[model samples]
Target: MMLSLALVCDHALIDQAGKLSVLGIFERIWVERFPAVHPRLHLVLRLKGRRTEIGDHPVTIVLHDPSGREILRGDGMVQIGEPPAGVTEVEAAAILVFDVPLETAGAYHFNVTVDSELLASLPVTVSQMPAPHPTPEGN
Candidate 1:
Protein backbone atom coordinates (compact mmCIF):
# COMPACT_ATOMS: atom_id res chain seq x y z
CA MET A 1 0.00 0.00 0.00
CA MET A 2 1.11 3.53 -0.74
CA LEU A 3 -0.03 6.87 0.61
CA SER A 4 -1.24 9.26 -2.06
CA LEU A 5 -2.58 12.11 0.03
CA ALA A 6 -2.65 13.08 3.69
CA LEU A 7 -3.69 16.40 5.12
CA VAL A 8 -5.31 18.26 7.99
CA CYS A 9 -8.53 20.05 7.23
CA ASP A 10 -11.74 21.36 8.70
CA HIS A 11 -13.88 18.79 6.96
CA ALA A 12 -13.63 15.87 4.60
CA LEU A 13 -15.86 13.24 3.10
CA ILE A 14 -15.59 10.24 0.87
CA ASP A 15 -18.45 9.42 -1.44
CA GLN A 16 -19.72 5.94 -2.18
CA ALA A 17 -17.93 6.07 -5.51
CA GLY A 18 -14.55 6.63 -3.81
CA LYS A 19 -14.48 10.35 -4.45
CA LEU A 20 -12.92 12.57 -1.79
CA SER A 21 -13.94 16.10 -0.81
CA VAL A 22 -11.80 18.26 1.46
CA LEU A 23 -12.25 21.81 2.70
CA GLY A 24 -10.36 24.35 4.81
CA ILE A 25 -7.04 22.61 4.58
CA PHE A 26 -4.42 24.03 6.92
CA GLU A 27 -1.09 23.16 8.53
CA ARG A 28 -0.97 25.74 11.29
CA ILE A 29 -3.14 26.55 14.28
CA TRP A 30 -3.32 29.92 15.94
CA VAL A 31 -4.62 30.22 19.48
CA GLU A 32 -5.14 32.98 21.95
CA ARG A 33 -3.40 31.20 24.77
CA PHE A 34 -1.50 28.10 25.79
CA PRO A 35 -3.18 24.91 27.00
CA ALA A 36 -5.88 25.38 24.41
CA VAL A 37 -8.25 22.88 22.97
CA HIS A 38 -8.86 23.02 19.25
CA PRO A 39 -12.52 22.13 19.10
CA ARG A 40 -12.32 20.02 15.99
CA LEU A 41 -9.86 18.84 13.38
CA HIS A 42 -10.13 16.53 10.41
CA LEU A 43 -7.46 14.24 9.01
CA VAL A 44 -7.98 13.01 5.49
CA LEU A 45 -5.98 10.26 3.90
CA ARG A 46 -5.97 8.47 0.56
CA LEU A 47 -4.06 5.31 -0.14
CA LYS A 48 -3.46 3.09 -3.12
CA GLY A 49 -3.27 -0.68 -2.78
CA ARG A 50 -1.76 -3.11 -5.16
CA ARG A 51 -3.85 -5.84 -6.72
CA THR A 52 -2.11 -8.50 -4.68
CA GLU A 53 -3.09 -6.78 -1.44
CA ILE A 54 -6.83 -7.14 -1.65
CA GLY A 55 -8.11 -7.63 1.87
CA ASP A 56 -8.84 -6.01 5.17
CA HIS A 57 -5.94 -4.15 6.74
CA PRO A 58 -5.60 -2.61 10.17
CA VAL A 59 -5.09 1.14 10.16
CA THR A 60 -3.95 3.29 13.05
CA ILE A 61 -3.57 7.04 13.53
CA VAL A 62 -1.74 8.70 16.37
CA LEU A 63 -1.35 12.30 17.41
CA HIS A 64 1.89 13.41 18.99
CA ASP A 65 2.89 16.63 20.67
CA PRO A 66 6.03 18.74 20.34
CA SER A 67 7.84 16.73 22.98
CA GLY A 68 7.05 13.51 21.15
CA ARG A 69 4.33 12.60 23.50
CA GLU A 70 1.35 10.62 22.28
CA ILE A 71 -1.81 12.61 22.74
CA LEU A 72 -4.53 10.66 20.97
CA ARG A 73 -4.93 7.52 18.97
CA GLY A 74 -7.54 6.19 16.54
CA ASP A 75 -7.83 2.74 15.04
CA GLY A 76 -9.84 1.47 12.12
CA MET A 77 -9.93 -1.00 9.31
CA VAL A 78 -9.48 -0.53 5.57
CA GLN A 79 -10.79 -2.95 3.05
CA ILE A 80 -8.94 -3.10 -0.23
CA GLY A 81 -11.67 -4.01 -2.65
CA GLU A 82 -11.03 -5.99 -5.78
CA PRO A 83 -9.73 -3.84 -8.58
CA PRO A 84 -11.76 -3.12 -11.66
CA ALA A 85 -11.61 -5.27 -14.79
CA GLY A 86 -8.15 -4.18 -15.89
CA VAL A 87 -7.02 -2.01 -13.03
CA THR A 88 -3.78 -2.86 -11.28
CA GLU A 89 -4.46 -1.04 -8.03
CA VAL A 90 -7.30 -0.07 -5.73
CA GLU A 91 -7.88 3.10 -3.78
CA ALA A 92 -9.03 3.76 -0.23
CA ALA A 93 -10.08 6.88 1.56
CA ALA A 94 -10.22 7.61 5.30
CA ILE A 95 -11.41 10.58 7.30
CA LEU A 96 -10.60 10.87 11.00
CA VAL A 97 -11.83 13.55 13.37
CA PHE A 98 -9.91 14.78 16.40
CA ASP A 99 -10.47 17.10 19.31
CA VAL A 100 -6.89 18.31 19.54
CA PRO A 101 -5.73 19.46 22.93
CA LEU A 102 -2.61 21.55 22.83
CA GLU A 103 -0.66 22.35 25.96
CA THR A 104 2.07 24.47 24.43
CA ALA A 105 2.92 26.14 21.18
CA GLY A 106 5.09 23.92 19.05
CA ALA A 107 5.11 21.25 16.40
CA TYR A 108 2.57 18.43 16.42
CA HIS A 109 2.20 15.46 14.14
CA PHE A 110 -0.39 12.99 13.03
CA ASN A 111 1.05 9.63 12.12
CA VAL A 112 -0.68 7.06 9.98
CA THR A 113 0.09 3.39 10.03
CA VAL A 114 -1.26 0.58 7.88
CA ASP A 115 -0.82 -3.03 8.83
CA SER A 116 1.45 -1.91 11.63
CA GLU A 117 3.74 -0.06 9.24
CA LEU A 118 4.13 3.70 9.28
CA LEU A 119 2.81 5.18 6.05
CA ALA A 120 2.52 8.90 6.53
CA SER A 121 3.22 11.68 9.01
CA LEU A 122 1.44 15.04 8.80
CA PRO A 123 2.85 17.96 10.75
CA VAL A 124 0.83 20.76 12.32
CA THR A 125 2.34 23.79 13.96
CA VAL A 126 0.56 25.45 16.84
CA SER A 127 1.39 29.04 17.65
CA GLN A 128 -0.02 31.76 19.83
CA MET A 129 -1.59 34.67 18.03
CA PRO A 130 -0.26 37.94 19.32
CA ALA A 131 -2.73 40.11 21.16
CA PRO A 132 -3.85 43.30 19.46
CA HIS A 133 -2.57 46.59 20.80
CA PRO A 134 -4.87 49.48 21.49
CA THR A 135 -4.41 52.59 19.35
CA PRO A 136 -4.26 56.10 20.78
CA GLU A 137 -7.47 58.04 20.16
CA GLY A 138 -5.60 61.19 19.03
CA ASN A 139 -3.41 59.31 16.61
Candidate 2:
Protein backbone atom coordinates (compact mmCIF):
# COMPACT_ATOMS: atom_id res chain seq x y z
CA MET A 1 0.00 0.00 0.00
CA MET A 2 1.23 3.51 -0.91
CA LEU A 3 0.35 6.61 1.07
CA SER A 4 0.46 10.23 0.01
CA LEU A 5 0.82 13.27 2.24
CA ALA A 6 -0.91 16.58 1.77
CA LEU A 7 0.29 19.90 3.16
CA VAL A 8 -2.01 22.72 4.16
CA CYS A 9 -1.53 26.37 4.81
CA ASP A 10 -3.73 28.86 6.65
CA HIS A 11 -3.59 32.64 6.74
CA ALA A 12 -5.86 35.62 6.19
CA LEU A 13 -5.06 36.52 2.67
CA ILE A 14 -5.63 40.12 1.59
CA ASP A 15 -8.00 40.20 -1.35
CA GLN A 16 -6.39 41.51 -4.53
CA ALA A 17 -2.85 42.76 -4.78
CA GLY A 18 -0.91 46.03 -5.05
CA LYS A 19 0.70 47.20 -8.27
CA LEU A 20 1.93 50.19 -10.19
CA SER A 21 -0.61 51.62 -12.57
CA VAL A 22 0.14 54.89 -14.32
CA LEU A 23 3.56 56.44 -14.68
CA GLY A 24 4.09 59.72 -16.49
CA ILE A 25 5.34 63.29 -16.29
CA PHE A 26 3.30 66.27 -15.15
CA GLU A 27 3.34 68.53 -18.17
CA ARG A 28 2.36 71.56 -16.15
CA ILE A 29 2.70 72.96 -12.67
CA TRP A 30 0.46 75.32 -10.66
CA VAL A 31 3.31 77.50 -9.45
CA GLU A 32 4.91 77.88 -12.85
CA ARG A 33 1.55 78.38 -14.60
CA PHE A 34 3.34 76.85 -17.56
CA PRO A 35 5.13 73.64 -18.40
CA ALA A 36 7.24 72.21 -15.61
CA VAL A 37 10.94 72.92 -15.61
CA HIS A 38 12.97 69.87 -14.65
CA PRO A 39 9.73 68.90 -13.01
CA ARG A 40 9.49 65.77 -10.95
CA LEU A 41 7.80 62.83 -12.58
CA HIS A 42 4.69 61.37 -10.98
CA LEU A 43 3.97 57.67 -10.62
CA VAL A 44 0.55 56.40 -9.69
CA LEU A 45 0.19 53.10 -7.91
CA ARG A 46 -3.09 51.38 -7.16
CA LEU A 47 -3.84 48.72 -4.61
CA LYS A 48 -7.01 46.76 -4.98
CA GLY A 49 -9.17 45.30 -2.22
CA ARG A 50 -8.92 45.94 1.51
CA ARG A 51 -5.80 47.63 2.76
CA THR A 52 -3.38 45.88 5.12
CA GLU A 53 -0.05 46.93 6.48
CA ILE A 54 2.63 44.78 4.83
CA GLY A 55 5.54 46.52 6.46
CA ASP A 56 7.92 48.02 3.94
CA HIS A 57 7.95 46.78 0.37
CA PRO A 58 10.92 47.43 -1.86
CA VAL A 59 10.21 49.38 -5.05
CA THR A 60 12.52 50.47 -7.81
CA ILE A 61 12.01 52.96 -10.61
CA VAL A 62 14.23 53.10 -13.65
CA LEU A 63 14.17 55.78 -16.30
CA HIS A 64 15.60 55.25 -19.77
CA ASP A 65 16.14 57.85 -22.42
CA PRO A 66 14.83 57.71 -25.96
CA SER A 67 18.03 56.06 -27.05
CA GLY A 68 17.32 53.22 -24.64
CA ARG A 69 20.11 54.34 -22.36
CA GLU A 70 19.45 54.46 -18.65
CA ILE A 71 19.08 57.97 -17.30
CA LEU A 72 18.22 57.51 -13.67
CA ARG A 73 17.44 54.89 -11.08
CA GLY A 74 15.81 55.15 -7.67
CA ASP A 75 14.83 52.87 -4.83
CA GLY A 76 12.09 53.48 -2.33
CA MET A 77 9.68 51.84 0.06
CA VAL A 78 5.89 51.63 -0.21
CA GLN A 79 3.58 51.34 2.75
CA ILE A 80 0.07 49.92 2.82
CA GLY A 81 -2.65 50.82 5.28
CA GLU A 82 -5.79 49.02 6.37
CA PRO A 83 -9.22 50.42 5.74
CA PRO A 84 -11.83 51.10 8.36
CA ALA A 85 -14.75 48.85 9.09
CA GLY A 86 -17.44 48.55 6.40
CA VAL A 87 -15.02 49.90 3.84
CA THR A 88 -13.97 47.85 0.84
CA GLU A 89 -12.52 50.42 -1.47
CA VAL A 90 -9.12 50.04 -3.05
CA GLU A 91 -6.28 52.45 -2.34
CA ALA A 92 -4.59 54.61 -4.96
CA ALA A 93 -1.83 57.23 -4.98
CA ALA A 94 0.44 59.55 -6.96
CA ILE A 95 4.05 59.54 -5.84
CA LEU A 96 6.30 62.40 -6.89
CA VAL A 97 9.66 63.98 -5.91
CA PHE A 98 11.66 61.45 -7.94
CA ASP A 99 15.27 62.46 -8.64
CA VAL A 100 15.16 62.34 -12.45
CA PRO A 101 16.62 65.39 -14.14
CA LEU A 102 14.07 67.44 -16.06
CA GLU A 103 16.88 68.99 -18.03
CA THR A 104 17.44 65.72 -19.85
CA ALA A 105 14.82 66.39 -22.48
CA GLY A 106 13.77 63.33 -24.44
CA ALA A 107 11.37 60.50 -24.52
CA TYR A 108 11.72 58.52 -21.31
CA HIS A 109 10.58 55.06 -20.41
CA PHE A 110 9.88 54.02 -16.85
CA ASN A 111 10.31 50.56 -15.42
CA VAL A 112 8.82 49.89 -11.99
CA THR A 113 9.15 46.74 -9.98
CA VAL A 114 7.92 45.48 -6.62
CA ASP A 115 9.91 42.88 -4.78
CA SER A 116 11.59 41.90 -8.06
CA GLU A 117 8.30 41.64 -9.89
CA LEU A 118 7.93 43.85 -12.88
CA LEU A 119 4.78 45.90 -12.39
CA ALA A 120 4.66 48.58 -15.03
CA SER A 121 6.52 50.11 -17.94
CA LEU A 122 5.39 53.54 -19.14
CA PRO A 123 6.72 55.98 -21.70
CA VAL A 124 6.62 59.78 -21.64
CA THR A 125 8.01 62.62 -23.68
CA VAL A 126 10.01 65.48 -22.19
CA SER A 127 10.69 68.46 -24.42
CA GLN A 128 13.32 71.13 -24.03
CA MET A 129 12.21 74.69 -23.46
CA PRO A 130 13.17 77.33 -25.97
CA ALA A 131 15.08 80.46 -25.02
CA PRO A 132 12.93 82.74 -22.89
CA HIS A 133 12.11 86.10 -24.33
CA PRO A 134 13.38 89.08 -22.36
CA THR A 135 10.76 91.13 -20.53
CA PRO A 136 10.28 94.46 -22.23
CA GLU A 137 11.44 97.47 -20.18
CA GLY A 138 8.53 99.26 -18.44
CA ASN A 139 4.93 98.07 -18.79
Candidate 3:
Protein backbone atom coordinates (compact mmCIF):
# COMPACT_ATOMS: atom_id res chain seq x y z
CA MET A 1 0.00 0.00 0.00
CA MET A 2 1.06 3.58 -0.59
CA LEU A 3 0.08 6.77 1.14
CA SER A 4 -1.20 9.16 -1.46
CA LEU A 5 -2.19 11.93 0.88
CA ALA A 6 -2.06 12.76 4.57
CA LEU A 7 -3.03 15.99 6.28
CA VAL A 8 -3.97 17.62 9.57
CA CYS A 9 -6.89 19.94 9.61
CA ASP A 10 -8.90 21.76 12.29
CA HIS A 11 -12.13 19.91 11.54
CA ALA A 12 -13.03 16.80 9.64
CA LEU A 13 -16.72 16.07 9.40
CA ILE A 14 -18.22 12.91 7.99
CA ASP A 15 -21.86 13.17 7.10
CA GLN A 16 -24.41 10.38 7.43
CA ALA A 17 -24.17 9.84 3.70
CA GLY A 18 -20.42 9.14 4.00
CA LYS A 19 -19.39 12.50 2.68
CA LEU A 20 -16.38 14.27 4.13
CA SER A 21 -16.19 18.00 4.73
CA VAL A 22 -13.16 19.74 6.18
CA LEU A 23 -12.87 23.18 7.72
CA GLY A 24 -10.27 25.46 9.23
CA ILE A 25 -7.40 23.75 7.47
CA PHE A 26 -4.23 24.78 9.26
CA GLU A 27 -0.71 23.63 10.06
CA ARG A 28 0.09 25.88 13.00
CA ILE A 29 -1.61 26.46 16.33
CA TRP A 30 -1.08 29.82 17.99
CA VAL A 31 -2.09 30.09 21.62
CA GLU A 32 -2.22 33.57 23.09
CA ARG A 33 -2.27 32.37 26.68
CA PHE A 34 -0.61 29.64 28.64
CA PRO A 35 -2.20 26.30 29.59
CA ALA A 36 -5.03 26.44 27.08
CA VAL A 37 -6.87 23.67 25.42
CA HIS A 38 -5.48 23.01 21.97
CA PRO A 39 -8.96 22.09 20.76
CA ARG A 40 -9.60 19.82 17.75
CA LEU A 41 -7.53 18.29 15.00
CA HIS A 42 -8.61 16.29 12.00
CA LEU A 43 -6.55 13.60 10.33
CA VAL A 44 -7.19 13.14 6.66
CA LEU A 45 -5.59 10.27 4.80
CA ARG A 46 -5.81 8.62 1.42
CA LEU A 47 -4.16 5.33 0.64
CA LYS A 48 -3.74 3.30 -2.46
CA GLY A 49 -3.92 -0.43 -2.16
CA ARG A 50 -2.26 -2.87 -4.45
CA ARG A 51 -4.36 -4.70 -6.97
CA THR A 52 -4.04 -7.94 -5.03
CA GLU A 53 -5.30 -6.33 -1.83
CA ILE A 54 -8.93 -6.88 -0.94
CA GLY A 55 -10.36 -7.03 2.53
CA ASP A 56 -11.16 -5.13 5.71
CA HIS A 57 -8.15 -3.37 7.20
CA PRO A 58 -7.50 -1.40 10.34
CA VAL A 59 -5.98 2.05 10.11
CA THR A 60 -4.43 3.77 13.09
CA ILE A 61 -3.66 7.41 13.56
CA VAL A 62 -1.24 8.51 16.25
CA LEU A 63 -0.14 11.92 17.40
CA HIS A 64 3.09 12.72 19.19
CA ASP A 65 4.51 15.79 20.85
CA PRO A 66 7.82 17.45 20.17
CA SER A 67 9.45 15.17 22.70
CA GLY A 68 8.31 12.09 20.72
CA ARG A 69 5.76 11.14 23.34
CA GLU A 70 2.47 9.78 22.13
CA ILE A 71 -0.36 12.16 22.96
CA LEU A 72 -3.46 10.97 21.04
CA ARG A 73 -4.61 8.01 19.03
CA GLY A 74 -7.52 7.02 16.79
CA ASP A 75 -8.39 3.91 14.81
CA GLY A 76 -10.78 3.08 11.99
CA MET A 77 -11.43 0.39 9.45
CA VAL A 78 -11.00 0.61 5.72
CA GLN A 79 -12.47 -1.73 3.15
CA ILE A 80 -10.32 -2.34 0.15
CA GLY A 81 -11.95 -3.69 -2.94
CA GLU A 82 -10.33 -5.47 -5.82
CA PRO A 83 -9.09 -3.17 -8.50
CA PRO A 84 -10.82 -3.07 -11.85
CA ALA A 85 -9.36 -4.88 -14.79
CA GLY A 86 -6.02 -3.47 -15.90
CA VAL A 87 -5.91 -1.22 -12.86
CA THR A 88 -2.77 -1.26 -10.71
CA GLU A 89 -4.15 0.11 -7.48
CA VAL A 90 -7.27 1.43 -5.81
CA GLU A 91 -7.66 4.35 -3.43
CA ALA A 92 -9.39 4.48 -0.05
CA ALA A 93 -9.97 7.52 2.11
CA ALA A 94 -10.10 7.73 5.90
CA ILE A 95 -10.74 10.60 8.26
CA LEU A 96 -10.19 10.58 12.02
CA VAL A 97 -10.95 13.31 14.56
CA PHE A 98 -8.93 13.97 17.67
CA ASP A 99 -8.91 16.67 20.31
CA VAL A 100 -5.34 17.86 20.40
CA PRO A 101 -3.54 17.32 23.70
CA LEU A 102 -3.08 20.38 25.83
CA GLU A 103 0.58 21.05 26.48
CA THR A 104 3.37 23.49 26.01
CA ALA A 105 3.95 24.95 22.58
CA GLY A 106 6.12 22.94 20.20
CA ALA A 107 6.05 20.82 17.09
CA TYR A 108 3.79 17.79 16.79
CA HIS A 109 3.47 14.81 14.49
CA PHE A 110 0.42 13.10 13.13
CA ASN A 111 1.20 9.58 11.97
CA VAL A 112 -0.84 7.30 9.76
CA THR A 113 -0.41 3.57 9.89
CA VAL A 114 -2.00 0.51 8.32
CA ASP A 115 -1.52 -3.06 9.43
CA SER A 116 1.23 -1.99 11.78
CA GLU A 117 3.13 -0.31 9.00
CA LEU A 118 3.76 3.41 9.05
CA LEU A 119 2.48 5.19 5.99
CA ALA A 120 3.01 8.89 6.58
CA SER A 121 3.67 11.56 9.17
CA LEU A 122 2.30 15.07 9.06
CA PRO A 123 3.94 17.77 11.15
CA VAL A 124 2.16 20.56 12.99
CA THR A 125 3.46 23.28 15.25
CA VAL A 126 1.77 24.76 18.30
CA SER A 127 3.42 27.89 19.56
CA GLN A 128 2.57 30.66 21.98
CA MET A 129 3.43 33.42 19.59
CA PRO A 130 3.47 36.90 21.02
CA ALA A 131 1.07 39.43 19.63
CA PRO A 132 2.59 41.92 17.24
CA HIS A 133 2.92 45.42 18.54
CA PRO A 134 0.95 47.97 16.60
CA THR A 135 2.90 50.72 14.89
CA PRO A 136 2.04 54.36 15.57
CA GLU A 137 -0.40 55.69 13.00
CA GLY A 138 1.25 59.11 12.73
CA ASN A 139 4.75 57.74 12.17
Pick the lDDT winner.
1
Candidate 2 C-alpha error for residue 88, in Å:
5.0
| TM-score (all chains, Cα) for each model | 0.94, 0.51, 0.79
Please give, for residues 1-139, the per-residue lDDT of candidate 1 as tens digits: 9889999999898888767999999999999998999977999988898899999999999999999999999998999889879999888888888889999999999999999999989999999999899999997
lDDT of 3 at 43: 77
Badly placed stretches (over 4 Å) of model 3 are: 13-22, 83-86, 131-139
Clashing pairs in 2: none
What is the TM-score (0 to 1) of candidate 2? 0.51
| Residue 56 Cα positional deviation in candidate 2, in Å, after optimal superposition | 3.0
Q: What C-alpha lDDT do the candidate models reach, one value each?
A: 0.92, 0.51, 0.80
Give the 10-residue window scoring lowest on summed lDDT in candidate 3.
33-42
Candidate 1: worst-modelled 10 consecutive residues by lDDT = 11-20
Question: How much does each candidate deviate from the true structure in C-alpha RMSD?
Answer: 1.3, 13.8, 3.3
lDDT tens digits by residue: candidate 3, 16-128: 86567877788898888766677556778777888777787788888888899998887878988877699987877777766676577888888888888998888898889
Per-residue CA lDDT of candidate 2, range 1-139, in tens? 0001111111112235633334332433222223344434455454333444334567787877778887778788765455667775534343534545544555677777766777677666666546678998994
- The lDDT-based order of candidates, best leading, equals 1, 3, 2
